[model samples]
Target: MALFWFLHLYLSQFKWITALLQKHSEIRMRGIDLPDDLIVEVLSLLPVKSLLQLKCVNKSWNSLISDPKFVKLHLQLSTPNRNLALVQYDRPDCRVLTFPLNHLLHNPSTTIPTHQFICKDNIQFQVIGSCHGLICLLRKSYTSDHTNIHFRFWNPATRVISKELGSFQQSNYHAHDRHRYIFGYDNFTGSYKVVLMCSGKVKIFNIGDNIWTEISSFPRFDHDVSLGSDRVNNGVYLNGTVNWIAFQDDLSCSTYSWMQRDTTLEQYMIILLDLGTETYKQLQPPRGDGVNLVVPRFEPTIAVLMDCLCFSHYVKRTHFIIWKMTKFGFEQSWTQFLKISFQNLQVDNNFSDWNQYQTFMFPLCLSENGETLILASSLPGLCQVILYNLRRNRVERTKDLGRIWSFAKDYVESLASIR
Candidate 1:
């Protein structure tokens, strides 16, 4: 009876072990059924934060997420379609708002009012520019003793803020004032730089290293004749260099009594600051009536169209001309793309002051497949943003964001992946 009982117990134990083995094999087979490509596709769509968190799920997943090829593929898949929203801030107590890019693109007749958002009171930010789903912010602060300025690299979609770069400090020189012009990121350095122009001195601040380096090589023109006050017409980052148009005085016209030189013809020069060498060089504009062209109003009037830089010029009281850079280099060709007269649009009133709204308006940065120009107009009580399709030659009114200080576009693709 004891032998029989031992046999029974041994058989039962063997069967139980076999069942457990079978279950483990089934689970392994199920995991193998999932294709590698499918896993990659699904994982690529998840935000970077989620991907980073999932690294601990398994060894395969960790390796995949860290793969350089996967990162590139994820970024390509997540590129945001270029569409911009112009939010308004009217009431002192109003909140920040966000609008959809599709609504602005498809519905020409649809006009949605600006909605409010949280955290407007605590953060004072202005959109300097956008690139690769990242928006550069100029954060300003006011206290009792001294003023503080910082450049914040932010991702609007993910709400990720990089470490703030405090006031740039360097030996032998100080920033002219706190009201310095902070340009967006230079692609070469993958960092933001500021141009400090005050008291006849110009300096640059590299936000990545928090270093204030002096730009002593820039040609100095008399402060009186230079376009110092014309913030919009001053310095613009194009192709790699900061381009500034200034008027140089002919010193020969000095009367000796006041030491004032006679005004010469207005010259627009392209100042290229090589990121590698940290130096500035002047490039002359293409020969022709280039110097004869009047400076466009100092507003956010310049935009990147295709591979060229474009801007609108008030040709006459009733006409506007669009100019485009045709070739690269300082002496490259600049051709007129469009000569638009008010009569061409059949508009009765003259748009003489159209540039006034340019400062408050933000461009809807569109991808190659998106619309050409997106702009917002801020009126006294009511504000409207308009999107212009260059390919279709159509203009449509977008949502009516109430009074807003500044606005930007947060691309959906920008949130995908942890980077």
Candidate 2:
């Protein structure tokens, strides 16, 4: 099935090339020659790997492939070829792995080859997230100030990386600070931006700008109260907004008190930060029938599934429920999408010591036809990538991608340059 789609798209591009060639004979009599615009239209349909080799054909083609407009065009056309981006750590070394989704879906039993980007730096960095083929890496400064953070944007497909952008300092840092950051694209400004949320204060850093602008602080909340993958406060980037599932609290409730696990007065809400407006908004999360919306011990995660915001949380540590927001910014559009039992997911069923070894399942990506969903079942130090069939409601296959440092994201290859 994957091969058919690739052949279909490949043949479709050749059809355009054939038609253009046929028209060249007729247009030869006219004064106008075959324009480069038509050539660019066909070239954009090819894969990035092919485009890189084609650059050696002529200087004109090399210049055309490097243009910003061509980069955007290629990105728009390469949406169908999504890959899984995984960051695995082996002791002190880190590796960024990219596996083509089509290959994995087609050959479930085979060990799919992955493209790896080895980080040789002495300092370890974490993948904040990916946007427009750019992976944002975060590293803490080695200096004495514990509040300082540095960022670097790298295009794994293009193999181009920008210089260390910042050693920006947070207003105040604590040992318990989650210090989460999200990378997003601002459609209004046609640029990329990174937003950092820590200590109830919010800051925005534009990609090209060498400065950080402090925005409205997040509603007073505990740093440990945010629900996300691997217990990290990761924001779901979708449609120019970064969304997180957080518990809202009053100033009277201190962060230290949160360690006591007292949640009778706390409330969970979805916080949205608009990259364009640089402001914050709160929305209520999904509420299901006979479902308790509060879970103080377990963490609920927010992810983008089929371009819709999805909320997933474990019920009594026995069942996992996923809710999808069909319409953005509309609380009424929330719908319960999936409810799978722990037995079905093959998760450990040790109920006596469940809290200590609880597993969190996150929906990483959905198939093109939407019949299958890839999930990351994260344990204490291990992560398993599972292929689940939604139509059949069963786990089709599960592969251990080794001990991953963070959850995987959908990666698309592009000619995006961070410089």
Candidate 3:
């Protein structure tokens, strides 16, 4: 009787323990039931590529990740100031490709292999500018009576393309046409606006409303003065304004009018177009002796660093002076950001050939914390991307890739969807 009682008690205790463990296992498999907000906060720290892969875990996760609000939040929380190179190679064929910055920064042996994203576009175009993860691409067909210059808004990350957003029915596609466009988002209106700039004609198009309205006309230049096309200037979108280096045409008489001179007589200025008020203003370039140098090739490049307008001007071969604005629209706030010398670099055989091609270096991307600047050189032959460690005061060169000048832009991967 005693043995039977003992055996029965042992069996009951074992069964109860097993049942408790089974319940615990079920909780573990289902997860701890974290709060939705907390889950999103944690998930937002992940890269978009990983987030897309995690969507298949369950329905709840899929819905959470697919939410537009979540995507915007994720974009806000994403790691900024990272290096992602958008390479547009014009050789063999015109192609837009992307690669990790470290591929060009670190030693080949120590470099982590990053997948190169070769974007496939159905139409022939060139990237004009990128904002809020939406890249603006320009495609021109001059066969028609009016110049059919179309803009394509593409979110390379989400693979969403907004085709035929707008077009400029230009009178004629002049090789020396100064027509350009800037795509920017207006915080006040909560809409994306494209600023169309020509020699004298200026217009603004609101993407959300799908309407184009003529704004104030650009400051006119004398007929004798030469007006430059978009290729001759650098266009930057910042603070709901489009900023570009506008040049005053040189009208001085020369013996050889058509001759290509090593030195130019043009003066560069910053042209600002406010998206909110539809106004135009010009900011003085950073006051310096180097800023006065005539640019034989396009040299006055504009960029945005942490809500401040930054300008880069080259004095001579590979020597550039960087200026930053501490206060927006304040000329007094302009300060020398950094002085970089690429002339001392250990150039390879291609470097000479690059110089002959009138190659120039421009800022491609800046690292998080703004410590490093990755620059690409436009060269006809293989040229390495140059990485400058601003903090360490060090200059490093990568292996020879295609001419650093291959069509490339600073690209950021995001989940921004464009319908």
Compose the digit string of candidate 3's lDDT tens values, residues 1-419: 34234433543454422442344356558885545665576567566666776677678889988988888888898664233434444444445545555555555323323344445444356767777777777776665556677777777665678868777667754645556667787867868888776555677888877778886455563211222223324477887888776555343333134224443423556777778877778777777654455554434677776567888766555567678999888877888888876554333323333234343556666666578776666544435566778888777766555553334566567776656
Q: Rate the local accuracy (lDDT) of all candidates.
A: 0.49, 0.69, 0.61
Best by TM-score: 2
At residue 215, candidate 2 shows an lDDT of 77
Candidate 2, superposed: residue stretches over 4 Å from native: 1-33, 112-115, 141-148, 169-173, 226-232, 251-266, 294-296, 351-359, 380-382
lDDT of 2 by residue, 1-419 (tens): 34334434655665533443445445666866656766676678777777787677567789999999999998887545687766766556556666778877776665645435545455566778888888887765455545557887877666788888867665443546667678899988988888776766777888767678887445665434543233244777889998876666543344446434434212567888888987777877777774555554555678888899988776666787889999997878889999888788777645444343333567787898999888876665336667788888777554565546244677678888776
Best by lDDT: 2
lDDT of 1 at 381: 34
Instruction: For candidate 1, write residues 245-295 as lDDT tens digits.
Output: 333423312223222222222343445565545676655543326456443
- Rank ordering of all candidates by lDDT, starting from the highest: 2, 3, 1
